[model samples]
Target: MKAVAGRMKRWRNSLRLRLLAGTLVWIVVAVLAAGWGLSSLFNKHVSRQFDAELGTHLDQLAANLVFDEAQTLRLRAPLSDPRLARPLSGLYWQVDRMGAAGEPETVALLRSRSLWDAVLAVPPDALADGEMHVHHVRGPNDEPLRMIEQVLRPAEYPDQALRLIVAATEDLISEPVARFNDLLGFALGALSLGLIGAVVVQVRTAWMPLERLREGLAQVHDGRNAAIEGRFPSEIQPLVDEFNGVLARNAEIVVRARTQAGNLAHAIKTPLAVLANAANRDDSALARVVVEQVALAQLQVDHHLARARAAAAVQIPGQRTAIRPVMEALVRVMERVHVERGVQITVGDFPETTAFRGETQDLQEMLGNLLDNAYKWASSRVDVKVAARNGDLVVTVEDDGRGLDASVREIVLERGVRTDEQRPGSGLGLAIVRDLALLYGGDIALDASPRGGLRASLRLPRA
Candidate 1:
């Protein structure tokens, strides 16, 4: 129920739904308006028929009423005229007269017995000759009647006026029009129901492509597929095609990255073996010199390996990770490594600085390299900091110890090019760090820290 209610709410808030519902309502309204207009027109036509028939009856009644020279009024028609005897039928007639003549002729002219005792109600004011008008009358059954009345004077006695009324029950005049109205209402209802059904079908048909799109996305998210391909409606095919293109490109890049890692491994290992062999040889002073050369070459190989490994750890655009945990883990690992040396490394406090746009392990490895370099050379302490600056992950590591030669400043970052000949190390620390930075699509530079020691700054891309 809740889900259905939510769906209804969403539909109600949607512009498309509003348009559909508005259209259906307008259609129903139009039907009702047309029905009302047409019903009124048809009712007028029915009333005209009644009026025409009544007019004919009035003419007949007028012809029948004639006054002799004595001004005596008499009805020539029988009370049983076929028109008047029809019960529950539509037609009626009545005639009224004042005294006419003979024996003071206090007799009535004519009347429909349908009125029972009641007389037709006519205007009190005199009517001109042939001036047709309408009046209300009552039947003997007491039902309402609409009488079309006319006043007439015979040709011989023009002063003696007569009222001739012809009428039919209002029900007779209105029945067909009422039936038309009922049918019109039923038709509007049926049309509204049909329109609602069509609206539902239209909405489902229109959004079917979107549903398919969501299912395609779900397949990719579940790792069951790397790309989407299906027949889509023409309007939405472009969007699905673009998303498929992205997925295809990402899949291609992943394959290339894997291949590059393997090739980089092969490229470094052969040279590394040669270097190890050369470094193991001990023959002359120059041979001892060859060991230094070979040791440096091996350092370059190791740096290449680290670079190849870092390549696989890179994140795509718009990706992000929590940095503090990776940083803390590295710090703990470094502290554990230097436990025997009594080195106290203090990481700066930046509590809310967690999010960064890079792979977690890559950042941790980069920090590890820079801090390890500091740990090796620092006489007392090393300080590390991380913060975001101008769309970069800005990392700074500082140590208070002897700095390197200004001339060989850049050479320190070259693969295996250590400034100190007697440091007795592989000399690939800075080089490996540089390669890792480059592999992760970032950069690192060495400079004098504010504490008069080596400061290394690493900048990785932001999301």
Candidate 2:
């Protein structure tokens, strides 16, 4: 259920989904409108044909009517239609005599056998001679019918005027129209489904290039490629080219920054070296102060230079350094350097595939400081572990030495703050490590190690 909700949210946020839904809605409305229009037209046409049939019958009845020598009206021959002879057959005709002038009464004259001793209840309307009118009337069986009637004066008997009507049950028109409507509904329903299917296919096909662009960007993010790769449609190619241009500009900026940092370092170190030499040549109180200040200035220069280099390296994309190899190399060097101390360096649970998303030098700088500090303080053993967690690569270096007070842990991370002044160090090791980690969008923390010394936990971006 949660997965379904998540998919629903994604669908609501997607442009393709919105477009397809809107198109389908329009299709349904259009199909319904067209279906209604066709049904109405078909019904109208059927009604006209039914009225025409009734008109033909009325004409036939008029042609057949005659008057005997007694001046009484009669049909010379029966209607040619067989249904007209059957009682209550839903098809019938009737004749009536209109009252003479100044009279409002009408009298029944003759009717088809289908009337079955019953009369058609037509409305009493004044119809002109030879003019026809249509109406809804009750038939012999009390069924609804559509009737067409005409009034005329017989040529053989000018004194007598006759009204003629022919009708059929309303179902004759309704049944065919209803059947046609059902068929039209089914056809439109099928057409709607087909259109929806086509829309889905079209939307997916039209958006396929965007999907490829996304995959290409992912590859660049993961350090697999320097820029977007592959051919694209004309509409999308410009976007790809613009993005590549941005990446190129960013790369140029990072390179220039690194070069400037290096030049500044070299330019400062030369004068600092000259001051150190002059202070060594004279052994006075002023010389001692000059040496102390020169050392202080050198520390500051090294600190800022490392920061500047790390800041520039962080902006350089597509940099990945394998965790296992770097850690192994660092351990070998630390073990060799601290061999006389009898400190044993061991690796634990390090994944070969885990990688840091930064420069190799930056990774080595952070890990190197942490491991060297651990080795320097440890009495017998140091352990290093590397793992990936929460989209970060965590490298923990623990040593079996006297751990610092919990209150001093945060202070030790500050520049020029050392827990033990007796230790031969400028106190920038942990500070540099923290700065480098942070520059790479990562962090470093110091905690009490379970092995009895400090634990330096370094969290860096993972690739």
Candidate 3:
């Protein structure tokens, strides 16, 4: 049931299916209506022609009909149609004499050879003199017949009245009508198929621009292009223009935020340096406290500035940087900075094509913090590895120093929390790394390393 519902949901969500379904329904309805209307009209026309032929024969029989002096009815001249003389031919004529003015019963006075000892069992009805009436009745062999009859009073024998009838099998009318309906059905079926094909082509042609637009957007989103590019139809051009405009504005906003953060950092660092120098001139307790507070203020400023820069930069699209080169460069910088500690930084083999889907600067900031901590804490060596996994770039850095206890691992990731005060650095390295990773829709995790020190693993979106 869930699978059926899912299929139904997908069909409802498709524009092509909706268009095709609606067009096909209308085509079926129109074809059916046309077939019915054409068939009905053809049947009516053939029926009228059939009735006219019978009526003409009836008129000929009436004009030639007369009674001799013996009061016997006879036709002065025979009908022109040859079927009237052939036995059970399907066309026949008869003459009958009425017993009384209002009597329904009639005696057959004469009939064509086509009757072949059989009679047309026409229903009794009030037939006015010289006026023809039509009916459907049984003829020879119980075959259905369409009949026309007229009652007439002869001038030579005014007291004697006669009825004349001409009939033919109903197949004359039915056969042609059946043939026409079959042909009409076949023609309409072909037309319906042609129309459906036309609808399919029109739908696909009309949606081609949308398909192209989707591909273009995917390129932009996957960081292969900075903006969508293509000439679209007028109907979709406005949407493309609006989307490109939004991307441009986003990049501008990111740049503006980074510039503001940099300006604020520069404005605050000078005063902090002066305060630190003044406090260093005295060895009193108050001087030491002042120096410690100034240093803490500087770290807070740096932390917030990094957070602001990363948060703003992450909002822009189409940024990608190779992982191997960035990690290699950061490792060299870390080795040089911690040269006195003799910490050996080793990078593992990694694919050069492995890339992070974010700004190069942001990637450097996050990796720099992680590697700096590992280098500072390592006893002898630090190991860094980069790999692409599950559409993400995973970077792991481990050190050979004493690893943190499980209880303090999570604590050290918090802002300004130091595991050991003797370590010559602010305790915001892992916290800053955590904040930067989260800004890029990524994260950093710390665990016990096989090298015996803390292992920091960073996961970011792969380009």
- Candidate 2: regions farther than 4 A off: 1-9, 69-74, 86-89, 96-110, 113-144, 149-163, 277-296, 333-351, 369-434, 443-459
Instruction: Rank candidates, lDDT, best first.
Output: 2, 3, 1
Residue pairs with colliding backbones in model 3 are none
lDDT of 3 by residue, 163-191 (tens): 78899999998899888988998899899
Selected candidate, larger lDDT, 1 vs 3: 3
lDDT of 2 by residue, 92-173 (tens): 9998877876233344689899987888777878777788999998877778999998988878777777788899999999
The model with the greatest lDDT is 2
Q: Residue 286 of model 3: what lDDT?
A: 98
lDDT of predicted model 1: 0.71
TM-score of each: 0.51, 0.77, 0.75
Q: Compare candidates 2 and 3 on TM-score and give the better one.
A: 2
Q: In order, what lDDT does every prediction score?
A: 0.71, 0.89, 0.87
